[model samples]
Target chain A: MTKPNEFAPAWQVAEAIRSGDVPAEDVTRAALDRIAALDPKVNAFTDVTAERALTEARQVDADRAAGKTLGPLAGVPMAAKNLFDITGISTRAGSKINRELPPAEEDGELLKRLSAAGAILLGGLNMGEYAYDFTGENDHDGACRNPHDTARMAGGSSSGSGAAVAAGLVSLALGSDTNGSIRVPSSFCGTFGLKPTYGRLTRYGTFPFCDSLDHLGPFARSVRDLALAYDVMQGPDPRDHACANRPAEPALPSLNEGISDLRIAVLGGYFSTDGMPEAAAALAPVAKALDADKTIDADGIDAGRAAAFIITNCESSRLHLPNLRARADDFDQDTRDRFLAGAMLPASWYVRALQVRHWYREMFAKLFETVDILLAPATPFPAPLIGQRTIEIRGKEMLTRPNIGLFTQPISAIGLPVCAVPVFSGEMPLGVQVIGAPWREDLCLRVAGHLEKEGVAVAQAPSGF
Target chain B: MTMSDDDFDSEAFIRTMAPSLGLSLDEERVAGVSVFLSIAKGMADILDAAPVPENSLELASVFDAGQTAQQAKAE
Candidate 1:
């Protein structure tokens, strides 16, 4: 019989539940018990749906008794970021200002689909206020702590999604990435997170950060779980016009296909600069594991990052115009100031920046014609101390809040699929993004799987979990 | 209100120009927004310096012929 307290992968848990060796209820109960015991230190959850989780697990057990076929993630415990609506909660979105809005009419589309795939909702996870933050510190909810070292930061805005998985509170959770919400948190907390291609997964029922750039996806401890969660949650939706009208290409069947004919390289030039020694050191083993040789120069990345910053400012500011005017006092100070500044930007700058985005995307298109995958450090450095503000990279100090997304922003700006795979030094865990061409998540996952198999990249659960 | 010259004190700029623009901002809010704008303006300066080609303003819609081929073959 499988041990209830064991930290098993989602795939293993599903198989255990299927074989009736460990009942789904016992597994769910163990996860809930862990959350209750350790969440005070980690602050990974804003809410824990104990009743809902037990109910879902019972149904899975009942189905197995009746000889019904189980889904790929049957009986797997999961949670969603607070930005996702959970039917009866006022999608607080990690902000004081949004708490009073009426409860969401229904669960977000992603949750509904995951439930159908037999993943139970443990609850909603904590996030940065209004999802505008890169650092995991939240003004409304407490700061989501790194599982490895409680005093260190868990990068956000998908703060709790990463910490929970790393702490073994739950095996899977969902988070959104506008710039680097999913990837940054995944890096800091030492977990695997997938930011699927923009327009790949439907974004219906999630809080909007920047509609043009918003992408919803999953986080987990293993690459297989990342691909499994992504494959199940994807498809077309009329409500999210940005979601492409394409059939779901399930990644499970090809996840273990290996990186046989794949051509991989590390991003040079801009990606090489501003990295901490430890952060830069994490990439060497991954390169050796996949035999990645060629160096690709991604020119104009700085301008792309700046353009993304402007677009985020312009779009998010407009979205919050009504709320900002009425109750700016209710918002986190960091979120409030950025929105107000964006509102004041010259219209010409926003438009010109969007045009520049087009130029940059065109450049990537031509560049992707040759390379199959590109690897880059997910964050410039490992998780900073919880309250530390400035990062000294090569003698120059930069603000910690915005520069945390330095490496992630440029890739996200153009809507590419990136899988953040955890790598480690002596104690702290770091991550490198296995990047793919737009809609080529298969290649990225293949490379990530290769690294995981080689022990070069793997999610190390925080000690004492 | 605007960058009339180079004498750009963030606090003074918002304080002097906010009234004409009909925005009644508290001192804290104005101070916050000013600092945020100053940082963003620094980023915009880097972008504004990068030379973009003429007539390349249309949004680039991505198309993957290779994926299309792979899909068709699978079918």
Candidate 2:
């Protein structure tokens, strides 16, 4: 008999439940018990939702008993970054002030979709304040500790999503990626994450960050879980105006199509791991496995990263302008200073940044003609120690927070689909970004699925989990 | 459009610009805000140096205009 292991992949858990080997309620309760015992050390969950999780799991069990069809993910446990509205709970986008607001009347669209697919909602995970941070440290809620070391950072703004999934409290979780929030945490926490093409998933019922760049996606122990979750959640909603009207093209069925005929290349210039040996080491094996020898550059990436930064600043600052005036003192100092600076940006600069974004997107469109997929380091290095301010790269000390997303910001700026896969090649697991052209998330996930099958990329649960 | 460090002062810009936007900065907050503005200025300068074609347009649409354009293009 297969015993219920919280660390098992979501697909396996679903299969176990479907086979009647384990009850959904038993699995959900085990997850709740794990979170209760481990979350104190990891700080991954902001809310537990134990009662609701048990009720939902019981329904799944009753349905199976009645010969009703079970959904693809019929009883797996999952959580969302706190930015996602959880119906009666206030959406605390990692800020203290938002906690005082009224409870959300409806759950976020993604959460509803996942629930419909029969994934039990464990609760909301912690994140960087207002999703402005790349580091997982938050002031209102304590810094989400890395499960691997516990002393290190969990990466942000989806810190809790990555940590919870990596720590095996949930088989998979939802995270928002606006400038590498999903990828950074995945890279640091050793999990597979997908940042689908911007507007591919509905962002309705989620707290606003930079509307221009925000994307919601999944972090899971395996690429199949990422695709399964993404497949079920794919569709257009009138609620999120940015959501594309295109119908959902399921990536799960085509995940094993393999990359035999597709042209793959390594992103060289801006995506280079110049001073980061850990990232270089992580990418080398994956590159060798893919037989990708061509190193290409996407020109004007500096401008792309810069434009992304400016757009993020201007848009997010404008969104929080009222808060800055009334409750500036309430925000984490790290988030507050950046917003303060963003508010001072002249209209001309914001316009110019958008113009640069257009030009940059054109550059990527041309680059994709030659290659179907691109590979780059998901983060410069593994998770830095929690609260460690600066890190030395190439003998120059740089602020650890902003630099963590150096490779990620440029790609996300143009709204490309990327799958960040954890490679456990060293003392600490590192991640490599399998990037595909706009709307080609299938290619990205397929390549990652290939890597996982080949054992070049794998998400190992943190030691002692 | 490349702003030389000699050409712009982030501290002075914040000191003057914050009030115009109805943002009040405490005396201690000015330096921290300047740090990020300076970083933004550096990035803005990079964007300025990059050569964009004359036809390269900004990526925003007025309200539902983008959605309407997409629908029209599809039809």
Candidate 3:
């Protein structure tokens, strides 16, 4: 194999592998080599399954020689957030105790689907402990740092996911976004991340954070890669109640259909407020590129964010109660304390929040009537300094961690399909969420792809890589 | 009604609530617990004040087992 595009997007890599311009083993080995050389500084990987990856690569070459059909994602190197179950290793979900659980007997549904599509999993990447964090600083595992600047955060709990993709460590990686886990890192690390509608993809083998809000999706260097990964991973699973009976929906066919005829609108009100100048400034070019001239009011943002907070706390706390009881000392202090707090919430409040969720979803439904897509900032600011605690947003100091999700939480609260598209401004990358009506991830990807084609948005490989 | 800001003392509240959930809290954990509880409470307040139709309670049942959670954003 000569001149393999090691840092190229997954689509390009697949094209190369298919044409015999580059051997699958060469591409896979190149990725493993890069990880060995740079991952120490980036902290993007918790484990690198080099042997498994090469073994899978060998099959691709063998299949081609024997004249077998290739999958859409065939021969691509990828990794998953540590939360997803892989056979023979306990799903870490970024925690000491979780890693102690027995090894999974079978791969999770998502992993199985990706593998069938010919995407080789390099290994699991690092994440926030228990999927309850916004910062990628895992207490058990080391912090996943930004590839653009080692001193900055990659965002979390999908920290390693964002860093790995942005650093070009892999062409594709998977991350779960309950509240901006995918988008936050996408914005900070300059990668494309998708949080498909809740239940759009099966979450059967992944560790749960909140049943109502959890979503499993991908992070990639291009919108097409995001669409390709999502399209391949779409289908139903009997094991995941949320995923059952949902017809397979593919977004790749219309991904480049352009947003010229689509009624794109910028989300205003709560979305426009409290953004730092740099963060707020990033949205203008995206809106201008799409010709987004109209603004829609999102009145229930506060209620939605509040409901998300309550529901996430209550549900996650309940899920971890047994652990909290048996081994509270073993859990991260912040995670344990948050769970304890959720346990203390009144039952009535949780019920009331659920009621409000219905109301919140309706508000978004009404907003979507005249809008095909909504554009909003993905984070209040770019990646914050590692170990830094507070940020000044619109001239007011705010806690860095909770406020990181200020824009993302409201949208995900009601399970909107949002693709976090990166916007470059000099050094660090900021992002905007290309949001669509429920089950309309196609529209979001279309808008993101349109921006990529216009050269208005693109993921820049970090210099550190 | 028990959601009053003045009535909420996080330390005292956790002390009272921990035993029921089989927990023992240390001071280091208290500050973190305090922050989270207040955020949870803040969210509850907004949802409580929002107007809702009488049948809103049953909408979330779709998230239950053997049921399709595919309907009702309530327009």
Candidate 4:
């Protein structure tokens, strides 16, 4: 068995299991041991599926012994943010309101696909309540801590997904992004995360926050592991109307193709503005590494964010209207209020935002015509303190929650595939958001792989876990 | 069109609308609603400034069918 401090990438673990260098049960036990030793301090998981993990691991061993074929991810331990339904587990979505709901009948589509690929579900991780907030601070469940600094926020609604992967408790974890959930946590935790284009993955069993903006993606310790998980998870689902019927693009091949001579653009104007100086500074190396030749202006990013917020609120309110009317007090105070406000949105405003969404998407298409990918900061800064409600930016105090997505919201509005590549400036972790045209996750991941190869923004697991 | 504060008691309006959409909110939820309202209202104003032509709506059909199919299976 690998020692507690010894770490192996997900691919390495899978290969070891496949070659019988280490038994699948031993790998499962090692991950369980790591979680037992570190989760108390990190607080990344809401539940640990110890019994189920062992069973799955043993199944893999049995299959291998019988000379049966195993999936690529067979025996690799991972977790999903609590928003995803695991068979027999209630998907709380990090809220107090869903505690009374019955356990799910089957695994969410994403989970089913991952399991089919041989990933062992370790347990459910924590997240922002109803995915309404950017900070991982949960009033019901204690906030998930950044592995780098326990007192700092991990960024959410995929908070625990980032925390678990970064702290080495799990090799891979799934996170849902609407706005910046997947990217933000990855940025804060110094892990690699991918937010595939909207409707790029199935949302059949995942709890909905805003149907239009929601995206499910992977968080992993390495870009390759993230690519592997994403490869297995990319496909259409009949149950999800938003899911487009498309053939999967082979992302792993593009990763090896390299990104030299690719026409990459560094997003200027809106993305470069309204963020921390460190965030802009972190992009310098990536710009130099990619030899980025153009500075593309994202003309309506601010406006896009506004429209996204409006649409998200209006749709979210519609989704929760019944609960808001009958049992409003049961919700996490922050999420409840956000939903109520969304409920109050005028129909005209929602319509206007939708109309603007069309315009914004066109604007992105025009930009992509000249560039393969656009690079910008993922979150404005590294994770702030868990309880920090306000932050000073350019001599002005801003609310942490709403402003955190200044760089993320606009890109998501157009449903572009984005890879959040973690960059380190000293001890704090920041990320560069690399965006590709719709259904161009291959291009996004390829550019991310290039960045990783050039040592621009390599993933770094949090120390002292 | 300009909407005066009097036209909607933004807080009360949101509270009433919350339950219809499967969201449950209470007194504390009022604050978040207010923030969202403020942000949404500001954004709606921006979109209204440059009204998009109806012809621009044709772009929604540009999605990748192959990618959509792969995503559906993964879902």
Best by lDDT: 2
- Per-residue lDDT tens digits for candidate 4, residues A400-462, read 888888888998988899999988976698988888998889888888888888787777766
lDDT of each: 0.87, 0.92, 0.87, 0.84
Residue A230 local lDDT, model 4: 94
For model 3, the local distance difference test gives: 0.87
DockQ of every candidate: 0.29, 0.51, 0.43, 0.39
**Model 3, B1-75: lDDT tens per residue?**
336777778778887888888887788777788888887777777787776776547454354553443431111
Residue A193 displacement (Å), model 3: 0.8
Ranked by TM-score, top first: 2, 3, 1, 4
lDDT of 3 at A265: 90
Q: Write the per-residue lDDT of candidate 2 for residues A1-465, one digit (tens) a residue.
A: 496677889999999998899999999999999999999999999998999899999999999999999998999999999999998899999999999999999999999999999999999999999999988899889999889989999999999999999999999899999999999999999999999999999998999999999999999999999999999999988767788978999998899988899999999988888878899999999999999999997789999999999999999999999999998999998899999999989887888898899888888999999999999999988999998999987568999988999989998998999999998878787899999999999999999999999999999878777
The true-versus-predicted C-alpha distance at residue A3 of model 3, in Å, is: 3.3
TM-score, first chain, each model: 0.98, 0.99, 0.98, 0.97
Candidate 4 lDDT score at position B37: 77
Model 4: lDDT to the true structure: 0.84
Better of 1 and 3 by DockQ: 3
- Give the fraction of native contacts in model 3: 0.73
Please tell me which model should have the higher TM-score, number 2 or number 3. 2
Name the candidate that leads on TM-score.
2
